[model samples]
Target: MSPELNAPGISEEDKARLTQSGIELSMQNRCGSYLQMNQDVLHAECQEEGIEVLSYRKAMEKYDWLKEYEWKAVPKDKDEITQYVASQTDPKGYVIIAHKGTKNILPIQACLYLGRETIQHVHNIIIAEEGAELHIISGCTSGGHVGQGAAHYGVSEFYIKKNAKISFTMIHTWTENIEVFPRSASIVEENGVFLSNYVCMQPVKKIQMYPTATLKGENSVARFSSIIIASPSSYLDIGSRAILEGKGASAELVTRAITKGGTIISRGQIIGKTAGTKGHLECKGLILKDGTIYAIPEIDGRVVGTELSHEAAVGKLAQEEIEYLMSRGLSEDEATATIIRGFLDVKIAGLPEALQKQIDATIDVAEKAGF
Candidate 1:
C-alpha cells in the first residue's frame, strides 16, 4: 500500500463495524475505493472483496502537513468523519478533510444523501501547495431519503499557494421541506487561479450562499460561473467575488440564473487594487414563470491604472431559441430542458471522466421530473 494509505486519524476497527451496520452507500478516499460511511465509525470496509479497510480520518492525515485540509458531506451522521478544530465557530460542528497532498491528482467528490427529518452541519477545507493543481466535485441530493425536518448547513474553505490552480464544481438539489445554507471562501496567492462552477437543480426550499475568492497576490486570478434553477417556494441568494492586489492581477465573475416557481437573488462583485490590476463581474438570469429574480453585479476599482467592468441580463428563455428547438422535434418542456442542459454542459464537461458521467446522469434525472 502507498504511504498515503497508512496515515493516521480513523481506526480500522471502526471501519469494520460500520460496514456490517447500515445501508452501505458509496464513500471513496484518494485511493479510489468505495466504502460505507456510517456515523458510528471513522473508517469503512474495503469494496475490493474486503481487501482493505477505508479510514476517513487516516486518509486525510496522509497528505503533507503543510497541506492540512478537511471535507464533509451533508446529512452527516454521528459516526461521520469530522474534527472539532475550533470552539467559537458558528453553527457549531465538525469538519472532515479528505485530502491535503502536495500533488493534486484525482478530483475529490462528496455526495450528500438526505431523507425526511434530517439536519446537519458539514464543513470542508482544501489546501493546495505551491504549484499544485486540484479539482473538487460535490453533489447534493435527497433521492432515497425522505420524511420531513430535513435541513443542512455547509461550509467550505480553500487556500491556494503561489502558482497553484484550484477548481470547485457543486451541484445542489432537494425535495420539499428542505433548506440549505452553503458558505464558502478561498484565498489565492501570487500567480494562482481559482475557478468555481455552481450548479443548482430543483430545490423547493431556501438556499442562501456566496462563494468568494480573494486574490491577495500579484497576478492572481479568479473566475466564478453558475447555473441556478428555482421552482415553487424556492429561494437562492448566491453569487461570487474576487479581490485583486499588486501588479497585473485580475478577476472575472459570471452567472446564469433561472426562476420559475419562486424567487432568486444574485449578488456578485470584483474589486481591483493598485496599478496593473483588473476586475469584471457578469450575471444573467432567466425567469420562466411569474416568479422574480434580482441581479446585482458590482465592480470596484481602487487604483487609477486598474480596469473594472460588469454585465447582467435578466429575462425568460428566448422564445426564438425555444421555438427553434421545438421546430426541431423537441416539445416545450424538452426545449427548455435542452437549453438548461447545454448551459450546464460547458462546466460539467470539464470534470473528471467518472464525475462527468455522474453529473450528466444527475441532470437527466432532474429533467425527467420536469426540471
Candidate 2:
C-alpha cells in the first residue's frame, strides 16, 4: 500500500474488516483508489493514464463543467439525507472520470471508513465519457471500536455517455450500531450500459436505499442485482428502479435476500415508456429463522410494443430440498448451509471475474459461520 493511502489510527483489526468489505489496502489489481476516513479524504489517486481520480473539492476547482453533472441525476431536495449532504460546508468525497474511448479492465476501489461516533456524509460523482468503460468497487464499513449513534449519509450520481459502459459493485459491512442511508441515481445515454451490484452480509442497525436509473437514449441498457442477509437486530429496506424512455432500451432488476431473526424488505420497479422497450423485475427471498422477508416487484408499460414483467417470491427453505442434500451423506447443518449458499447466488452478466470472486468470498465467509 502507498504510504499516503495508509491513514493513521487504522488498526490491524480494522484492516481485516475493510478487506471483508473488498477494500484492498495493497492496491493490487486496482487501476485507481480513493480512501476516506471519517470526513477526511486520506488519499485519491489514479494510476491509469486516461482516468482522473480527485477529491470532490479539487475536482470542482479544476473542471467548471462538473457543475453540470452535479446533482443532475439525484435531486438535492429529494429527502432529508440529500438535504444534510448538501448542507455540508466542507464537502467530502471523490470524483472519478474516465476520458473518452478509455478502457480499464482493473476497477477502481473506493473506501469509506467511519471510526468515530458521528455522522459521516459524502457526495460522489462518477462520469464516463463517450465510448469509455469504467468499473468501480466501493466498500463502506465502520471501525470495530466505533460506538453507538454512528450514521452514514451518502449521495452519488453517475453519468454514462453515448457508447459508454459503467459497472459499479458495492459491498457494505456496517456493524449493528450503525445506520446507513444512501441516495443515488444514474443516467444512460445512447448505446450506454449501466450495471449495478450490491452485497451486504453483515449485521446493521438500519439501512435504507433506493437507487434509480434512467435510460434516455436509444438502445441503452441497465441492470441491477443485489444479494443481502439480515441478522438479528438488523432492519434493511433496499430497492432499485429503472425507467426506460428511449426506443429499444431495456432493463432488469434481480435480488436475493435472506433474513435470520431480522427484517428485510426487497423492492424493485421498472417502467417502460417507449415502443420496443423491455423490462423485468424479480425478487426471491428466503427466511432462515423467525424473521420477516417482504418482496415487492412492479413493472409498468405505458406504450404499445413495450413489454414489462415482474415476479416475486418469499418463502422458507423447503424441507424436501434439505433432506435431499443430506441424503448425499452430508450433515444437516452442511446441507442447510449448502442450500442457502445456492439460494443467495445471483450472477451478474457483465461483472469482472475479480469482483465476482470477491462477492463470492464474502458470502463464503458468512456461510462458514452457519449463515
Candidate 3:
C-alpha cells in the first residue's frame, strides 16, 4: 500500500467511492497525489517525484514562492463573500510546485461531508518552472443524497514559466444542498500553453465562479472549455475570462450549459490587449421547465489585428424527442432529464480511460438524482 493512504483522517471508503466520480488512480500517474477535504478536516498524500506536493503549512515552510501572489486571485474586499472564508481559513490545503523539464500528472479531489465548513476554504498554488510539462485533474463534490447544505470557497493561482505547458481538467459534482465558489487565475510566460477543461455533472444549490488566465509572453496560448448541468432547485452562475497581452498570443473559450430547472447565468469574456491576438467565446444553453438560462458573452479589444468574437444559442429539447421518450412510459421530468443528460455529453481527445469510465459513472449518478 502507498504510504499516502495512511494519512490521518483520510477515508479509504471515500477514496473508493470517489473513483466512481472520475477520480482515477493509475500506475501511469506521475508521483501520485490525492487530497480530500471533508469539512475542516483535510488529508493529503503525494509521492516523491519532480513534482512536489505539500500541505499549506509544510509548503509555506519549504517553498520560496508562497505569499508572492497573495490576494491575487480572490481579492479581500469586505463585500466579497469569499473574503470571510479567506480570512478564517484553516491551516490545511495543498500546494503543487513542479520542477523544470518534469512530465507529471497530478490528481486533486475535494468534497463536502461529515459536517460544516460544510464551508471549506482551500488555497491551492501551482507552479511550473521553465520547460516543464504537466497534466492536472481535479474534482470537487458533495456527499451522495446528502441533506445538510455546505459551501466551498477555493482560491487557486498558477504560474507557468517560459516553454512550460499545463493541461488542467476539473470536475465538480455536488449534491442539492452544496454551494461552490472557486476563484482562480493563471499566468503563462512566452511559448507556454495553458489548457483548461471544466465539467459540472452533479447538481448544487448555488455556484458562482469565474476563473481567468493571462498570457504574458509571446506565442503563448490559452484554451478553456466547460460543460455544466444544473438541476431543479439549483442556481449556477459560471464564467471564464482570458486576457491576451503578448504578441501572437491567442485564447478561446467554449461552454455548454444544461438546466433541468432553477437558473443558470452563463458568462464568458475575452479581452485582447496586443496586436496579432485572436480570441473567441462560445456559449450554449439547454433548458427545461421551471428553468431560467442567461448567456452573456463579451469580447473587447483596443488594438487592430486583435480579433475577438462570440456565439451564443439557447433553447429546449425538441418536442418530438421528449414525446418519443414519454411514449416509453417515462415521466415528463424523466424524459426531459434524459435529454439534458445526453446534452452534457463531452468527448475530448487524450483524456485518461480510467477518468472517462469514472465520468460515465458520474453521469449515471447525476441522471438518477434529477438531471
RMSD versus native structure for model 2: 1.2
Residue-level lDDT tens digits of model 2 in 212-285:
99999999999999999999899999999999998999999999999999999998999989999999999999
User: Given candidate 3, what's the lDDT at residue 366?
Assistant: 67
- How well is each residue in 15-74 modelled by candidate 1, as lDDT tens digits? 222222211223433323222121222233222221222333444445455233433211
Better-scoring candidate (lDDT), 2 or 3: 2
Q: After the best TM-score superposition of candidate 2, give how far the Cα of residue 54 lies from its true spot, in angstroms.
A: 0.8
Among the numbered candidates, top TM-score falls to 2
- Compose the digit string of candidate 3's lDDT tens values, residues 1-371: 23333324435665544554455444244345555556344445555467776777678888666788655644656236557656763654577776898865444333323223366677777877899876676767555545665777777788888999877777776667877788888998999888878878566788888888999999898888788887887899999999999999989888888877778899899999999999989888887666888999999998888989999999978999989999999988888878876776665554545445555667777677765
Ranking by lDDT: 2, 3, 1
Per-model TM-score versus the true fold: 0.73, 0.98, 0.84
Which is superior by TM-score, 1 or 2? Answer: 2
Give residue 152's error in model 2 in angstroms. Answer: 0.5
